[model samples]
Target: AQSVTQLDSQVPVFEEAPVELRCNYSSSVSVYLFWYVQYPNQGLQLLLKYLSGSTLVKSINGFEAEFNKSQTSFHLRKPSVHISDTAEYFCAVRGSGGSNYKLTFGKGTLLTVNP
Candidate 1:
């Protein structure tokens, strides 16, 4: 069984502060890790992914995560968050290879950035 787990369902922070979102997974086989951000009813945008060969991966929007093999985790972090960063974040995983790219999403972590 492959599954993605986001430990926190909500994260609140003031503008300019740093934040870290926790994620973990358990799989009997290899899997691909991904982080997606959703703004309201819009589709999820790929924040970052850890496919292979590299443990550390980063996103264009100043977020990064490290893939730990032993712990089975990929935690997201940002140094200085903004008010514009307020959105719902989801952690997902897909089975390696093949066309079965079905992404199992977490419950979602709502990042509320207050001014």
Candidate 2:
């Protein structure tokens, strides 16, 4: 079994400021990690993921996350944020291999970009 935990429920940052949304997970087995973003009035979108290979993954919109095995963390970061970047961010994890559709998601962290 796996579980995810987002350290902050809300993150308020001025436009263009650097920000980081912390996420952590726990599991007895290897897992695939992901980050999902939800804009207002829209469904969640796949922001970035860490399936294998490099421990770092980046989104097209300048968001990036690094999978740290020792720390069991996959924290999202942006050097500079925009107004459009404001949204709810969710961290998720799924057990590797098999037909397991069981994915664990965090409560989510709402990013509010202020002017």
Candidate 3:
């Protein structure tokens, strides 16, 4: 079975500061990792993903994550964050082989960018 863990329930940072949201995954076989963000009344949106190819993946919004097979981790980071980046972020994992269409997600981390 595959699972995702987000240890931080909430992360607070001042505007224009750097932030990192930790994510860890566990699986017996190869897996696909994803990070989703949810705004205050909006549905979850895909932030970034690690499917194949490069071990390092990035998002357009200054966020990046590295797929570490040895450590089984996919931590998300951003050098500079804005108030608009304030939202809940979720880490998910799914098996790569099957078409199960099931993704195990973490509890989510709330990022609050203060002024």
lDDT of each: 0.91, 0.96, 0.94
Q: Which candidate has the top score in lDDT?
A: 2
- Model 1: CA > 4 A from native: none
Please name the candidate that would achieve the greatest TM-score relative to the true structure.
2
Model 3 Cα lDDT, one tens digit per residue, 1-115: 7788998999999999999999999988899999999999999999999999999899998899999999999999999999999999999999988675688999999999999
Candidate 2 yields a Cα-based lDDT of: 0.96
Candidate 2, residues 38-99, lDDT tens digits: the string is 99999999999999999999999899999999999999999999999999999999999887
Clashing pairs in 2: none
lDDT of 1 at 61: 83
Worst 10 residues of 1 by lDDT: 97-106
TM-score of each: 0.94, 0.97, 0.96
Error of 1 at 54 (Å): 1.6
**Candidate 2: minimum summed lDDT over ten consecutive residues — where?**
95-104
Kindly list the per-residue Cα lDDT of model 1 for residues 1-115, writing each as its tens digit: 6888899999999999999999999877789999999998898899999899989999888999999999999999999999989999999988897776777988889999999
TM-score of candidate 2 relative to the true fold: 0.97
Off by over 4 Å in 2: none
